[model samples]
Target: MLMKANEPVGSGQTGLSDSEAASLYRLMTWLSPSFPVGAFSYSSGIEWAVEAGDIVDATSLRHWLASMLADGAGLCDGIFLAQTHRAASSGDDVLLAEVAELASAFATSRERHLETTAQGRAFIEIARAAWNSPPLDRLIAVCEVAIVYPVAVGLVSAAHATPLAPTVHAFLHAVVSNWISAGARLVPLGQTDSQRLLVELEPVVSATATRALKASLDDLGSATFRADLASMRHEAQYTRLFRS
Candidate 1:
């Protein structure tokens, strides 16, 4: 298994039924919206598109979020996490650079940039000040000054010795939930409707993981064009409620 020397023996090895209650608690704490990462700020282009009359009601918003999740953001961020996890695991510098460059280029709009990179930078700042894991701290130096989101998140999870699947799971789910939360406020969708929307988006993340596992490097720059355009428009909106 090659875990760190201090790694605690687990039921998985001894079958003594010691649950990973500590790790699970850590995952829950990281995924909570109260982590102070500003995850609730950016809408990932949904605010703009909805304001532009592109998404009107619950049905349309669900379909829109579904499409974005299935074919757009979810698949892309999953890839980032996969690569980031790999880099963090092997302590690969070149892989880390690729992760950052990919994140910088993956953005299609200012809002997307704000959404991912800004969050990335925040993740690094908070991590350095609080948890202060070596791999995460090393990433702050070796990597470019702009710390990408998934990379920082990956390092924290890896340092905490969290499983890749659940870490990725929490990250993807958080991303989708933020969009749905914003949509509820923006389109005035009922609270129940937003809850239903999150329930539906779960599979989108799973399907995205499937496709991400098979995706090629050539597919990196691709994104939904109208969605990007709407994001650009939202920046100059006469009345602004959201940053994006």
Candidate 2:
């Protein structure tokens, strides 16, 4: 039988409720690298950074990504996702539309735009097919333009009744992990280093998500100019493995 959203899925007292467990599962699946969003195909300009010698090792990689999460696309995208989730959950189509428009225009470079929107379009297509809901339908109808990656994720998470906090954290975690993966391959780091980077980023991911939840649309901004330039430079890069 289909479990109601409020019903418990497991018997243990320490276990998550049905809705919580379902939300967790969905978030994990959606944010997983195996998801069909093609996230692994884009390095978010990490490739260019590596090539430019901005990231020569795991330590450098962590520093670069730390700035990104705190002052760049990572934080900006988090705010966008948080706003999108709030707008979506509140049934505020006008606000949702505004957020979506701003997010689409917020891309710093051509390849960056392509990177986000491509994954976004793919995310929405796959999600609608697999997890269709009325809210998702309304979100699509309201936002006529190309949805950005964060907006797509926020909208889908809200549609599924997933809480914003975990959704934001998971989304950011996936982004950080993807960047680390790119760094690992480019820098030729071992499995241990990559895993270590992820572990070290746990606090950063938490702090970012916390700030995102409290942030308003006015908080949307990025200070990571080098990272932005890397994305632009990636376009003309002679040898490239990533789309951005």
Question: How high is each candidate's TM-score?
Answer: 0.86, 0.94
lDDT tens digits by residue: candidate 1, 20-78: 56567767777678777888887777887777788999888888878777777777776
lDDT of 2 by residue, 95-205 (tens): 999999999999999999999999999999999999888779988889988999999999999999999999999999999999999889899799999999999999998
TM-score of 2: 0.94
Candidate 1, poorest ten consecutive residues by summed lDDT: 14-23
Best by lDDT: 2
Rate residue 156 of model 1 by lDDT.
Answer: 76
Model 1 spans > 4 angstroms off: 1-19, 213-221
Clashing pairs in 1: none
Residue 90's lDDT in candidate 1: 81
lDDT of 1: 0.74
Which candidate ranks first by TM-score, i.e. highest?
2
